[model samples]
Target: MLWEVDQKVKEAADALHPSSNVDHMQNILQDTLIHCWELLLKRHSATMQIDAKFQDLLFRALDYYVVGRLHEMLWWLVCERCQVVDQLVKTRLSHLRHAHLSALQLGVPAHYYTPLPAAVVELASLASVESAIGRLQCVHSTIELIQAQAKEARVTLHQYKDQEGEPELELTKEELMALLTTVVVQAQCSHLVANIYYMTHYVFSVTEDDPLWKSLGLLRNTLENIMKLDVARLPQPAKSIRKELSLQDLMQVSAEVESRFEAKGPSRSIGDITALDLQLHQLTQQIQLSTQAHSETHLTERNSPSRRSDRTMLSPTQDNSKSHSFREFLSSIPSSLRESLRRRQSQQRSAIQSSLNG
Candidate 1:
């Protein structure tokens, strides 16, 4: 089914452009995905063995699927589905929690495992399940954290009225996405993939139409799409309004600013107002100059490397002096004698240098 879908999608796509069908690199990804799916669905214990192979195929597919903003589209689709899964999983887990607790309280073991009398065996099974659950929970937390960050990101992407009172985007849409952000989403998918691999050992003969198989199929499609599409051209939404801020707390500051702009002397003359305006203009220039100077100082400090007093790289002259001083100290020893031992290190150094020069 995976192969048929990919093949038909390709044929339909290639029908428009004849050359599109000639991409030999495309087969590697499709072949690997199909092979992995076959392993997972039909064979026992082989799916786990070929996980690295599946992951490798997905990565290599990146080179082949360099068209139609596919990478960007796949990530967006994957994240959307992942977000959906997160909510569903959370709700499912909440409902299942009491049942699980009650089971533990009643001293019941997890179903699908061979019942044994040994205490150690039961504990091991519980531990294994706990560990697996921990991994899934970690992935859940990652998705939640990403969701929280995305809310703030949406705020940042909101249309803001600029100083000119014209709507402007604070940052470009491209700048909003971090390069490795997709990797976090992929890791979440991998967590599920691994759990499924573990589960397949007990469950037998999952039909192609099974919900579990369908989800895996969808995930595989997502991974495949991530490889081929042109990620750069994914459509970005127009900036939207978040909220309007018209706080009453700014009244005092607003009044002060109005007073500055309209300040006058004792005489209700135009000249006094003119003088005040000149003073305000000079103050603005002074502020700009001060800000520029501070910025330069800050940049210099940030770019310069910090120096340490205790340890530092020495000059060749310093190294030569240190060696000579150490030789002098060694020469002071009676048993060591004067010249030979003292000059030994220096001679060796000189010989090595001469050899390199020669």
Candidate 2:
């Protein structure tokens, strides 16, 4: 099953024109994956009586494998231009980081920017990796940390509500936005847009209910809002501070970090999924275990009143125009195709639950 899917995905990828639009390539990738998935289901259903759980696990492993392989192919196909874009991303992030640190030193409250610098650093680290899966994981982890911080801030606000002498400790929505602005500005990610695009169109297939997908959407909204912010309105660092944080120092630090990452070796790369010794069954088991653990944790959180409230507080107000545009995109998709894709994803989730019990 894995071999067949790989062959089909490779053939589709190889057929793409070198100059094809990224959006067009994304569509082709999705259509190809769906085709392969449907074919696998039909071919296997007749020969063997595999449970839906195993079937879903098989699909997930296949999805991971295909996406990882495509990441490698895309490096040569589209990411050659990404090298130039990455340099620009790095430069922008450097400026933002310097500004953030300067803001801290220049009397801006440290609490206002506490967790955001860590978030930026985490994302900047992800810039070194070219894998879509790697980037997705990094974004997911960063969002989780931020979400926890936001929850803590909310708790602190409630605890100090009646206290007379308490400091202004609550992280308000405006403060959150300001801090997020800093993060969006400083996320030094190479192929950032492409990674988001790839994950949305291919991996999650725009499953809005998925937590990771929702987190990515929130980040996308934050990135879009950057243009609306008045750059001059933001606090300016002292000339001395700006001079102290030289691009040379930034480059040296980045080089040391990259060296550390490299020393850990290619085992961290998504390409490890395609290793000859890693059997499909083993991959399926790993994904199944992970899915089960995640589902259990999600259920526990959903049932917690405090967790529910925290989620409500943490959810950002999305841009209405952007929401409408997304709705329009969904409506533009042929009803039949949308139904097919939705049905497939639903099956994948349901199958995971059913298999875990068995």
Candidate 3:
């Protein structure tokens, strides 16, 4: 039944739910296939030519239905982010509890104070992606009692007595301000990464056919004016949310173009793909140059934890040779802004150094 779609989606709503398997995710994917089949095969065929009334009515209905669906999806995103936070809390607490128990058993009460040294914060700075950065931020926020190492890898601990008068770590107001800013910024970056990956997969899926790949890639890139996957600037918190939203429109346009070109109606071409091909090539070259600059920057520096993530993530050295879709997308982006991206990276390093020096 069509209601199974809603039921399956409900099951996946809780990311921590035990039954939330890859199969449930597949069910959601299959739900889309089912809808496509129903629309193509089960629906009654149009008996006559499209009428003005039907067209007008359809547009009006879409205005209401589409808006509602957008709100629903947004709510879903909020729920997903909350679940991510929940999982982080559970995981961290589980570790802390184990450490606490171990300390009690060993008769070394000091181990209960801080299980792991705050130096790991330095390690966190090199998180492979922004989403990982965001998830780590959530973990940092939920537990007020933990050692935190700042940018210079110096551990700062604010330990006080708990209800039992034992020592515990805590965050101060100023520290909270910094941590909250990081949490929010990391969350935004994570969302941006999530959307980018989602759009990448969506585009690749639509363009997987023999004749469509090159043209569709160009069409999507043209619509987005994307150069180098725009990776360099994301280290800075987004200036405008709409900037990412516009990139998101790339996939929407790709989807629309796909439905039109592949449908079983009057065959039409969106003109020559030569221009599109040239554009894609130029964009990819630009990104490759940018990626190289980013890599050089990576070699020259290592900084505080928060800043470290951007450094390594900007030019991922791991597994780019793999034929994965996201890797291919990142590797192919043109680096027209390679110099600018490098300059920004330099500025960021300077700022970080200044912060450390201060």
Candidate with maximal TM-score:
2
Angstrom error at residue 219, model 2: 1.7
lDDT, model 3: 0.32
Looking at model 3, report the run of 10 residues with the lowest lDDT sum. 153-162
User: Whose TM-score is higher: candidate 1's or candidate 3's?
Assistant: 3
Query: How far in Å is the alpha carbon of 262 misplaced in model 1?
Result: 25
* Model 2 misplaced stretches (Cα beyond 4 Å): 21-24, 35-58, 75-91, 101-113, 116-118, 128-134, 150-175, 204-206, 235-358
Error of 2 at 10 (Å): 3.2
| Model 1 Cα shift for residue 104 (angstroms) | 47
Winner of 1 and 2 under TM-score: 2
Tens digits of per-residue lDDT for model 1, 1-358: 4454456445533443323321232342233333433333333344543454543344233223322212232223333433533443223223222111121122221110111123212222321332222322233333334334344333332321112333232322222122112322222232232332222211122224544444333333332333222322333222221111232323333454447645643333232232223333454566557767887554222222343432222211223453344334322322211233225424543453343344
TM-score of 1: 0.20
lDDT of 2 by residue, 290-341 (tens): 7678875542222212222333322233355644544443333231224555
Clashes of each: 7, 0, 13
- Whole-model Cα lDDT of every candidate shown, in order: 0.31, 0.52, 0.32
Residue ranges of candidate 1 with Cα displaced over 4 Å: 1-130, 156-181, 185-196, 199-221, 227-358
In the order shown, the candidates' Cα RMSDs to the true structure are 31.5, 19.0, 30.3
RMSD of 1: 31.5
Q: By descending lDDT, how would the candidates be arranged?
A: 2, 3, 1
